[model samples]
Target: MASGDEPSGELASSLRAIGARYQELSQFPTVTHAALGAGHATSAGGQTFPLYTECSQPDLARRRRLRFSRHYSVHRSPGSAVSVSRAALSAEIHHQLLGQLSPTGQHRAVLTRCPGLGHELLEVWGSTGRSCSVDLTALGKHGEVYKEGPFACLTWSHAEKQLLYVAEKSQPRPQPLFSWDAPGAARPAEEEEEEKGEQFLYHEDWGEALSTCSMPVLCVLDIEESSVTVLEGVPEDVSPGQALWSPDDSGVVFVGWWHAPFRLGLSACSNRRSGIFYLDLSNGRCELLSAEHRAACSPRLSPDGRRLLYLEGAVGGPHRQCLQLRMITWHTRLTATVLDVVQEPTDAFAGIYTDALPPQCWAADSRRALLSTPQRSRTDLLLVDTEAATVMNLTAGLPEGCWVLLTTQWDLLVATCSAPHQPPSLVVGVLPPAGQELTLHWVRAEDAPPVPGVSWKTLTVQVPCGEQSPPPCGTRAFEAVLLSPPAGAALHPLVVCPHGGPHSVFDARWRPTTAALCQLGFAVLMVNYRGSLGFGQAGIDSLLSRVGEQDVTDTQLAAERALESEPLDRRRVALLGGSHGAFIALHLLARHPEHYQACAVRSPVTNLATLLGTSDIPDWRYAALGLPYSFERVPRAEDLAAMLLRSPIAQAPRVRAPVLLCVGARDRRVCPTQALEFYRVLRARGVPVRLLWYPEGNHALSGVETEADVFGNCARWIIRHLGQPCRAAPGQHSP
Candidate 1:
């Protein structure tokens, strides 16, 4: 039977038994979206402020999508123990709900239900009891609506009469050669030929999870007129996204990316040639607001609309980098100029390590904004004062956890904080005064129950240094999160998980899979190898052109360190990775075959040579190799040789460990061919291997059923290969 398909033999019963462990952990609530009102209300009982928040958790038992959304009203009082009042706003099954609170505190919510399916509903509701429902499926004129990525947006106009969002530009309808019209119908020859030819034309997409998104255009929906118009002023070469209505509501300001170099994947990538542009609806003219060469995005206007804030980074090289905060003084609509650099990264601060700022990030003073950014292993909230050109870390005094700023309303700041040992908890606090940190009196808006019998600690791996050998990747050390099982066995099986995006960091936060694995009696190790984010830019820059060698070494050293210090069974160690992490896992399995007993890779990159030509971001391979990349650059013999030399396939013959490959057929990032190449090699060589193909899944394998199924099979593979029982009794060791 195919992977993810039901099996008929005894293996089917084993998977079902192993998958039951994820039920409770998968249902852990997560704060999805929250909105704060403009002002508070005073009642006879006490002063109460209303805050709207949405909580979602995966319904893994269901055969449909994994998560369901629940809306709540959180009420708080000043100078007293804050209590949250749970009032269910609605019980609708909405895939996404974007809530916008008007300046007058009138709530406006736009719900998109059954997204990505042929039938979709766009429902809008106002606090005054007025609502509108638009059948996006029946319209059939526009493409799928964007709900994620850099282009995703849903914002209300200043006057609250219209809604603005981003969606794929409509394509020309192609009809069959023999139409079902009247048998004797006469049609123009030119029109018939055009329709027939267009049916076969190929169009490129944004790739990976956003495969359906291409040709993003600004769309405006006028509620009063019940009309939707696609704005046409944007240049065809520029893909506009993250649109916002101008201060006066006369035009739309958005980020425009040039299509010349080919639209590289924009998922976790930040360094793309893009600029902030303003499109005037009256004259159908779009003007670039930021410099043409700067990679800029996330434009936020102040409350008074006097200044704009954004983040900018270098144009090329590593897809993700430390961003510099910038500001623009909007003296008037006629003219706006680059004001000054708000904050440049220093050795102490590590720059702005986030893609975008939260909505309503501005403080009550309007001179500062609250930003959540990663620093090493923890995510911290930063207070950026534009006037003083200073950045302060606000979470320095808070409890140990990853603190993320969700949204801000006036002087109130809302965030979700969590640690490896703790579940995510939504907390709201009043912004503390300058120079003073926030007191620990934050009111808990909502909290998720922690998983039982799971414990964790952060580990620092010191890179081995010899007199003759310098530190690999220009760093002497990195960190890892080790989740230990309950203290039953002296040594438990270990599963080393390295995250994707060599640039991405695995923060010390509660993750569903990590927690579930621990509950299943495996000590999980998440390594933040060199070049991972949160570390200084120097760390990120050190990994350039050294993809295979240094990254592989760093992961091995980290795992070795965890094994040495923790109660982990070095003999029963297994490997788990995705994307770039998978590349490293494969390299480790081949180079140091004895260190790992089994391996599981999801959407792995086995050969860079094959992926460079088929991936959405071909520049990734070149950049990883420290070579120049452009749309016009053709792969030469030497370049191909270098890619092959660094690939895991070059050393696949040395791999003796049983491997499990989880591939997404729709993945455009690493390409399914890369995984298939390794599978074919292992199979031909008589090596033990298995492949699970998710036909409808993307690079993330994010489908509700796909994720649960993949995790269950992965756990089963590791357990069986490591000589452990399929279902170990709680607080007991499996012989």
Candidate 2:
């Protein structure tokens, strides 16, 4: 029977029965598109044509082509026949002309004139594998002068029909490329004389003026004349990372507190409130914009250039709320109004609520916006109409996971959907004229490997809470997806996978881990506990202070319901999670140790106290746990205490499962020390625990190479401690 059609209890039984079948099917060899063939147009000489092919050709050809009309036309004289002899024209036509005229001919042509500025290299590739490069320097006065990577911030200036490039200095010194402008230029005699007089007046002045420190510098470049001017000494309080120019390009808006008149420390005012300042280019004058207690970011200019739009708050601090978008008018005064506000819903999903993820972007007209609302297991994208105060869910049925939406002309929407089992892909849709039906275009089916002999089925389970009736509380049924391995004679191991985000929801998608586990003969059950985002605010609000309790019960119930339908070895089950999911894993071991034999946690928040105190973004903890930054002023310590009661550190002594903890050393979100401290407590209690630390990683380990390592390590550890010898070695396959 298909698991999707079965009740939650029956679904689990079906999965156990097929475990062996899944394992057997997983051993077969898999095939993927490896290469494409070269062009096939015949040359004039009748020789087998060879146009251009980078790699080896595939055994079979599968071509998808698109063509459009060219806009070139010719005019002929009136009353005169313009027909020319085809033979004569063909003989005279050279290969170059033929290549240029041939619609199917492959030839590379220069696309952009600029070259060697703005990172010195810009490569663009089309879907058809055609690539073009542009050197910004070659564009003369039009080229960009400077570029910064990792974030791709760039700066350039034009003067006298010439473009000048300003690039950040590389490594050790790490200074902004102000030298790109006025390179090798000397100061005027009057300035030199004034500097000398100042030097004589004060020794400190001489040292300060002569010293050159590496910092973010703004340069003015003239591409036509090939000149550079280095504007070195910026205000001391200006943070380079937050420095940007005004919309009219007349001044720079610098955020931070200045220490000396010119030496700015990036980390100095990071924790404190920052002010905005405007620097005039004409007279080299600096003026304070506002003394507001907020860090400003993402400054955008209104279409009419009358106002400025920017997000204000410390980059990662407790005081950080998605500060309202304020429109600063240029009347030399700042009056602010909140463009977006959080709406409190009466029917919040199960009474669950969190400030919805701030709207990502505003529509071109500034009237509509996109917001992400994440429940415990899923996330939903909402289209907010500011005019009507109405919100429409754009991605209604997408499974629980992170998604991003991009708007095009006429409000056409494109989004990328992702989940544990599903690779991210672009989904395009057109909103109807009346905004009724959304026509989705399936450009391409996702290319994902099947789960060998196993198949996934969704089941509806009545999640029971002690306070509720036996049939379960609130919503009568919660949907859960179960993956059963191939047919097996004996009971197989079970793995309960709880998604990250106590407020996130789960969705259906292809997952490599799910495939691997099924191949290894384990039945996997994924649960969408309360507080997950998809079902709306109420669903997410339900799991607020109930994380360890409600979420754990949901996961346990899903697993037990699965077992009821299938014969399984209950003692062989395990739990696995990463991030918030990791918190769930630890919670399982602490509160229900007897249910699972082992657990794996990746970048888990072990101690709620440390999470609140040490996390780079203090606002996240404050919002999630409803805690105040200052202990002396905390109003709801009792509620905060109740939430912290589920901290894994507090329950370390009671956990009996062998544990594996993974952390990224440089993780700013969830401090690496949290995992270290938890490991310390667990190890001291004589509970089996192991820790893996990546020195140069962040909160997410999604880069391909790193992900491979993470998955491989997880698989190896699970197999090793679970007393399971590999039925087949890694990379071994059947014909």
Candidate 3:
């Protein structure tokens, strides 16, 4: 405790050892030979310092008895034998201690970070006269007032002084006391800051979690002043999103919520019911603008501000799932009319559907709205005329093997065309006046990768409509995109790769993974099974409660159709899928074990009962299990039992195919445990199974490295197991 003593660490450890021995010897007063206790030295000065304060009896009682170390030779009557060594800090020093302590290459930061595009904040990416330029003034500097993550409800005041956007609730909130780099006064550690407990939600449905009815706090960032202010008037229980300023700039309108009372697990719910609400920024009074009878989303005011355009769909489903476009007279009074409702999936471009929901845009004239609609197999750019009650397919001629993602200028269309044969390329186009068959004239704004040396075709399979035998789902036709190997002399092995989402679509866009499989000499059948988009809402609704039965039959019918139609090798058919598609693959194998030679699935949903408790989307179980879920609370035990009855595991006993389960350790949607549990059961039942767990992956396993591993390993697994007769796990083989 001397003023010049800076406290030696080696001396400290040696002193603690001696004191521990003294405490142990004190337990037995009868045996006392040496005066055992600690002595501290002033480092390498060779001078020992006496203990400054009386050691607490409690401290001595709790300290463990000292033992001889393997590293040191403990001699009787030893003076300090502890060695002083400098601590290793750098990563290189740690590497010298072990073999796998270094990275393969240096970590690089983004030198040219893509300054994302937005309308309310800045008008940058395009121009009228010369070459397009970007305004990077606001890049990388928004953190002064705003935190990270996607910004919702982006808008600017008519005067352009203030900007508004909704941000997520930042957790653990950086602290100075826990930080060693900075100095600060003292404060108690937050429970949230504890190691390895709660992590920030980074799931796909995080938007619902972070900005729900009870949360979605609108933030006003002052551009000139560099300050943030939380906007009031948004009701605490009514979560607001997709906000925009009114014509007079006196009010804010947004998609508003008043759904379930609780907030837990809202992120992955079907989240359908909502209505438009307006907040008068003047007096901070909020009022509902649209009726709550049906769900609606993407509320947008026209450029002339005369009318509003929005999407309406079934309640307790996606607000735009039905894909009906509606318009409301805004200025005079609020009167709503359906501009487009999906009555049929025929000639009319009545309902909209896309790979994911595309952004709705207003034409410069403000009468017609431009958007994308998913027709049976391909997604087409469509123009909806609200006043005329007619919809026109603007980019219908984009072709079957190609898909165009549209972005619009005030008048021209800026798009990126992605085809199975080539990489995506940016192009500019026009709608061509007066409809002499409006062709999307491409102006080649950016280059594309050379066209692939392969052939592609589309197949329309007549699938049964009913989940039940009498055909509750009827015999309806669905499409599949077939990618053929480069040189097809002999018949190729058929790979049935069904698209997932149960509500999603596989567009005719360039997918390297699928192309890679085809390049490896497999004829990949990318089946758009029942319950997929592009087909109307009826087709999707058909497979809802009948997840296992309908989708399974559809795949079988599709594969049969493929054999009848394409030059596919009958004995070499395999199944490949992920998520819901994986669910289909596993269930198909369980129900009809001999249906495929082998199967590969990634992050599969094997058991609804198992997933109901752990998954982010519990409603998915009830919905898929033919039970009604209100999204308010956990499903009952009886409900779960019924769910388990329909689970793929129920029929897992019939599985005869060699199965490979691809699991993502960090998957939050379909937790990795789901795949592990499935794998264990299959192995126990003597089914041939293998697991490929990706530690750095999520529900998608979508990183470049993970994706590459998936494609390579997947191809290898299918190829290796393709012709091997049903081989159960060892020790259980039949004679």
Q: Among these predicted structures, which one has the highest TM-score?
A: 1
Q: Each candidate's lDDT (Cα)?
A: 0.77, 0.48, 0.58
Q: Of 1 and 3, which scores higher on lDDT?
A: 1
The segments of candidate 1 whose C-alpha lies over 4 angstroms from its true place after superposition are 1-17, 38-40, 43-47, 66-83, 89-92, 95-99, 111-123, 131-141, 175-185, 188-196, 332-348, 467-474, 725-735
Better of 2 and 3 by TM-score: 3
Residue range 329-352, candidate 2, lDDT tens digits: 665657464343222222322111
Q: Give residue 185's error in model 1 in angstroms.
A: 4.2
Model 3: per-residue Cα lDDT at residue 674: 79
- lDDT (Cα, 0-100) at 72 in candidate 2: 11
lDDT of 1 at 538: 75
lDDT of 2 at 116: 33
Highest lDDT scorer: 1
Over 58-119, each residue of candidate 1 has an lDDT whose tens digit, in order, gives 76666654344444454544543355655555354455545555554674646466646646
Question: TM-score for all predictions?
Answer: 0.91, 0.55, 0.71
